[model samples]
Target: MLQINDLTFDAWGRRFFDHASVSVPPGAKVGLVGRNGVGKSTLFKLILGELPAGDGEIGYPKQARLASVDQEHPATPVPLLDTVLAADVERDRLLAALETAEPEQMGEIYARLSEIGADRAPSRAAEILSGLGFRQDDLARPMAEFSGGWRMRVALAAALFAEPDILLLDEPTNYLDLEGALWLESRLKKYPHTAVVISHDREILNNSCDHILHLIDGKLTLYPGGYDAFERQREEKAKVQEATRAKVEAQRAHLQSFVDRFRAKASKATQAQSRLKMLARLPPVSAVAIEHTTPFVLPSPDRPLAPPLVRLEGVTTGYDGVPILKGMNLRLDLDDRIGLLGVNGAGKSTFAKLVAGALPAMTGHLARSARLKVGWFHQHQIEALDPDDTPLDIIRREMPEASEAARRSRLAQYGLGAAKVETRVENLSGGERARLLLNLVAAEAPHLLILDEPTNHLDIDSRRALLDALNDYQGAVILITHDRSLMELVADRLWLAADGTIKPFEGDMDDYARFVVERAKQAGKAPTQIRAAEPDPPPKPAPARAKVPTGPARRRAEAAEAALARASQALADIDRALTDPGVFAENPAKAADLGRRREAAQAALEAAELEWLEAVEAYEAMKG
Candidate 1:
């Protein structure tokens, strides 16, 4: 268990906590949540001992191991698989010992390997990577081969693969697609150790965490159950606090008025004095700090939208002239709300770029309405902001002829008000910058909006605000984001971007999620395969028959039946061995060996049963 008592810390000339305390029990999955700059990461740093606490004590089990995702990874020649596998320090230590141990110590090394389950480390690492959207070929690739987002995934995979006693994940789903996020949520559900996940994804927090730790106004409050429960509890608490504050203020107002009106009168002087004393005795009530909703209201388009705002015929383009989309034909109606779906590195962003006119098609006819004004947002655009310029400064330059008052009014709608408007771009948080970008785009009153991962850095409140804006938006939207909730709420049609083509998905987001996950599961050459990608290629047509003698088909069915019987018997024997206490108590080495053997036997039995079923089906088809 990890215990924090009255923990207090100071950073950037501000004291974060005065007497905040919270306890994380063993195997507890806690979701840490708060607005930006509320000290969630600072608290994590203090727990990790990277920052010294100014007051109070934090205690944890002496032997507890910790694992956390790093935001940056050094470029290296090490294979991605090896980098992730190295996260298991115990396995690495054992392997290191093997290289230096004496001949007599070989048995000890082997026994330790069995105990640690190091034999399956390679496959385990690969499984984790594939779940995070890495292909079969990516495992052996060098770390430098991947982009920054992929490297972040590697960091997450390494942290999760470590299986530490305490795992700290801050925004782990930020860089993940819906499929990868769902896969991760499933994995976290089965995690056996303590974990604290810091995320803005509602579904992830709701499904993965068992508890919620809310940091508000320098005080830590622990709530029971998941995010939904926490939100309910918080709302209840806020209502109760508000009611109490109202009563207190009413009484205080009555007393203060009496003192003000009659304090100088001789007849009522004594009564006023009594009222003052009574008011002083009453406890002070501070109203709860309500959450800030995005004040960023989007202004409606100045002109009516025309149909077929964008049209592409025989579109083709790729990075460095390697065509990704060839002979593609797509049209965007003024009211179109299209959501792009694809796995990582599948060119979703490339398609968005092509539509937004950020990238010229290698060979295609691109047409747009004369009144079409595109508001294109991309991840790279965040870096393009001038570091020295404030949000207001940039807007002023963008709308040169507009009055200063107009620009400030527009930015104020985005919550940049006065204080944030003058702040340098470098000083703004990612979420703040995202809001500014949205505000800038909204100011243009464009007929078509192309947003790529616009909500990647936004908080829940900001996301809600954006969702509301999109629902009310009159412009055509071409969106590419991993936010499933947003996609479901805003998208009118789903488009699949894969296999070097752009096409409409026949089903909803759930169907697309399943397809992407299946793709990942088929990633590499692994011993145990997930359900086959395409499913048994529509079986061969059977010959028409009324009745036939059991001949070669019967023989093959009989052989298959025999194989299944043998496999089942072997599994039963292993199960019986596992149930015996003496088998494990007498020999730890033997027990660990049996455990691995049982898994293999189970897989073999499954395969054997499948083979038998196929044989029976074939025989039945032949008879038909």
Candidate 2:
């Protein structure tokens, strides 16, 4: 579906891609991976024509549509669902033309619309938005009402709804919560078109993609299967190369010894010269470079704390006397590893703050051991650092009693080398700042650590390093992150933030994934029922067709219901406007217009009812 031939790109005094060639087959989900600053995004820019490559060609089908979510969707007055529906440019164009097209042109447009299933666009867009963490009410909310992060999700939803031939997503889960991430993973696994995602979330790369594309040293290598398969194949290939290089080196050394011994004598001059030619003809084998990932330093607590480090009984907390989390009863022990899961704005961070003593409970009892020490690391901590301050300066303030050497040593332990010690916070990479803050927060070895969305800025390897450090640290941990792999590896138990309270979630990540997808499916059904003002009775669960219900049949049923609701609402709106006496008495043209619209809407409503009945029958057949 896409091809790059002999691509060479150079910028800022360095080459990003050197003779890199790769072909992505149609419908392949490819995960693009590399270390930080390896030009993965630069390659995307080249493909998008934002950057001109110094050499070679990037090609795809001429008519193919390419879509990417490079930035947040524009904040406009348009409703969320309308914004997403408009992403299907072909559908929008056909609909616009339908309003004025001549009679002869109507047949072709209608046929094309049917072929593309334009009638189902609303529910499809809603499903995408719901899967990305938007609520049923959010569909009608203006785009301008959402924050930047939610707007980013809207851009993603639009791209997914458009179903472009080539979909490019870069770190899509960065703005997502755990539930949204899980839903996206499920969605991408079923995406029909070609998708190339740049992500550091190991689980997404391993589960959502069928292929892995590794970019290293200005070269691209495509591997079959997921990330684990890529790692194994790369290791085997390296072993073979290293073995071959060793054999060639031994052969060269023997030839050189023969040349050295015989070069000084005429008897063997001809043979020595022949050996020199052989040595020169040997293929050069570059030695494999050992890659090193900097380790995170999280010191173990000096002393262990007693069990029940913290306990909350019916704890209610919020800002300005408005409760965000209510009736929360929970306990943390000295060695518990708890993974906190929720959607954004579900009060996970607020819970963390309450435990960290940054917020007081509005009501109910909170108890903690008087000697308990807690280390809190949150996403905002990195942003809170002063731009002009250096690591050395920060460490000096943090470790005032320590000598200059001790302060520098502490910074090094946090992965900041001497060169970075004096570097300003603004100059430091995100991973560096994260590393410094993470280590600094835990430097004193507190008995408990509350880390919230800690891996957002860290790359895959660095995330693994932090995971290792967390596992090694002898303290109770409360972890919140969108990275599923990190959560599974680090947390022993799961807690869910839902319905204005925290409670123990009774399942593993796989079960939680199913719940997320199923919840989105339910959310997709809610908006139509709300607008119709007559909710459908809930269908009884069919044990034999549990899996099939969440697939296409449920979506089609929801889409049909949405179409019906829209038709009914349009008819109702026309009738309501016609009820105004001024329209008939003061403006005859407006009255005629409303009458014509009402007729069309009535016909549309009848057609929608029949479609909804057929969809329901089809879905019921699937249940059977």
Candidate 3:
């Protein structure tokens, strides 16, 4: 469906693609994978004829329709559903023609209608919209009312509705929730037309693609299977190259040593000269330098503590009397793992800032324990570092009390060796700066870690390392990440921040995903479907009669039950703090009192929770 031969593209006087060739056959599902800024989007543009190829030819099959969903949406005031329907101009025209036909021309119109209908088939716009997670009611809602992520979904719907012979999707899963992403994957899997998608989501590529086109250093290499296959092949090739380089270097060293030893001796002079000449004729083996991979090292607190690290009571936060968060009462206990989830511009960052003490709440009181320490990693954390300082310098400044050997060891742990450690922070790439910032934070060993979009601009390897570190971290964590895979790996619970409130989901990642989808459907924001129920197991048999309880056993059981009740009451208090509107309002004094009360309640709740857990464990052990 699409073909490129000797294609070369240049931007800013730098060659991004040089004599690269690739092909997407009819009905093929191909994934374009590469490092950032490697011209994946440029290649798509060339195939779509949106950009001129510098030195090679790009061709599309004649009569083939093409569509693409780039990073940004085209500005339009029309509703999202209307925009998708407009893609099929022919369908609209045919409908219009059918509606206006007269009885007198029915005979003549019928023949023309048949021909036109056969050639220009009407599109199933409604079905396409539903399949892409748009509800029937949302069809008339203004596009401006939706967020950027939803707008991207609308654009995707339009592209799919067009029924193009070949579709080019670039970073389609960038801002999607798990449900939306899975919907797109299912659609692409069943799509009859050819497709080329560029995505950083390994799961998406593995599930939806059949072929892999890897772009590296202006060259395109094709792997027959999916992403997993491509990765395996790449690893094997790297191993082969390393072995070959090592063998060639060993032979060259051996020949050089023989020449040096025998060059001045007459008996072996002729042979030595022959060996020297042969060595000189041997082609040099150029091996790319392999750097040690950095492991993400999250800071470990010196001592783990009890609950009530931070408390928010009846707090409302926003700008200039406008509120984004209203009546939010929350408590952060030590060792709580929470994932903050919401669409873009949904106050996720604002909440993070409030917790970090970077911004004061408009009305609510923020309570933090005196001993609590916070380590915040912002979305644009690189900007927080001093550009003129070297990586080692930043580490030293951040951790002054540490020994020289310790500082160097920490730098090395973050993949900053002796050479790169000396390079100015300003000269580092985005990924490098991210690593350095993480290294600096890890040195602090704070008790509370707050990360905002930590996965942004990071490669797969870096992301994996960061996730691994989070898994091992013992401190309380609040992670604001767009990467679903990262969330699944690191988060033990989810905090859904939406519509001026925060809702907690005390379950696994899958349950949280289901909740989001169901909520969206309930709000008339997404398509709804009935799910099948699983079969239930048979009831258990009654237990045998128990022996009479002793006095100590009865007292212990009574105490445990009382503790459980107290913990339940504390939970209610925390909930009230979260739902208090005074904190979110414009009155600071009123908010402060409420905040204090909320903190006290949270402390009570934490103590209750601990006691309850202990009681439950005891109860379970006794029953066992």
Best by TM-score, which number?
Answer: 2
- Specify the highest-lDDT model's number: 2
Ranking by lDDT: 2, 1, 3
lDDT of 3: 0.72
lDDT of 3 at 294: 73
TM-score of 3: 0.64
Give a tens-digit lDDT track for model 3, residues 301-416. 98866678988898888777788888888998775778887554567888888888887788877788888788888746777767888877877777799898888887888877
Pairs of residues at least 3 apart in sequence or in different chains that clash in candidate 1: 296-413
Better of 1 and 3 by TM-score: 1
Q: Pick out the ten consecutive residues of candidate 2 with the lowest summed lDDT.
A: 532-541
Residue 176, candidate 2: C-alpha displacement in angstroms: 0.5
lDDT of 1 by residue, 1-624 (tens): 889899887789998887998888789999999888889888888888888888899888899998788585566899888899899988998899989899999898899899888988877787788888876667778999888889999999898889999999988888888668878877887889999988887777787889999988898998988888999999999899999999999999999999999999999999999999999998888988878776555565788656678888988888797987777788888667888877776688888888777788899898878877888888888989889989888888888998999988878877888988899999999999988887677677788788888888898778888988887676678888777878877787777776777876656665565555555454534713333242221112233311233334544677789899999999999999889999888999989999999999999999999999998988888756
In the range 1-624, model 2's lDDT, one tens digit per residue, is 999999999999999999999999999999999888889899999999999777899999999999999999999999988999999999999999999999999999999999999988887887888899887777888999999999999999999999999999998998999889999999999999999999999999999999999999999999999989998998998988898899899999999999999998999999999999999999988776566788988888888777789999999999999999999999998868899988888899999999999999999999998999999999898888999999999999998899999898888778788889999999998888888888888988899999998888788889989988886787889999999998887777788887789987756677678778887776666555434332222233344433332224544687789899999999999999998998889999989988998999999999999999998999888766
lDDT of each: 0.81, 0.88, 0.72
Local lDDT at 167 for model 2: 97
10 residues in a row with least lDDT, candidate 1: 534-543
Candidate 2 has what TM-score?
Answer: 0.84
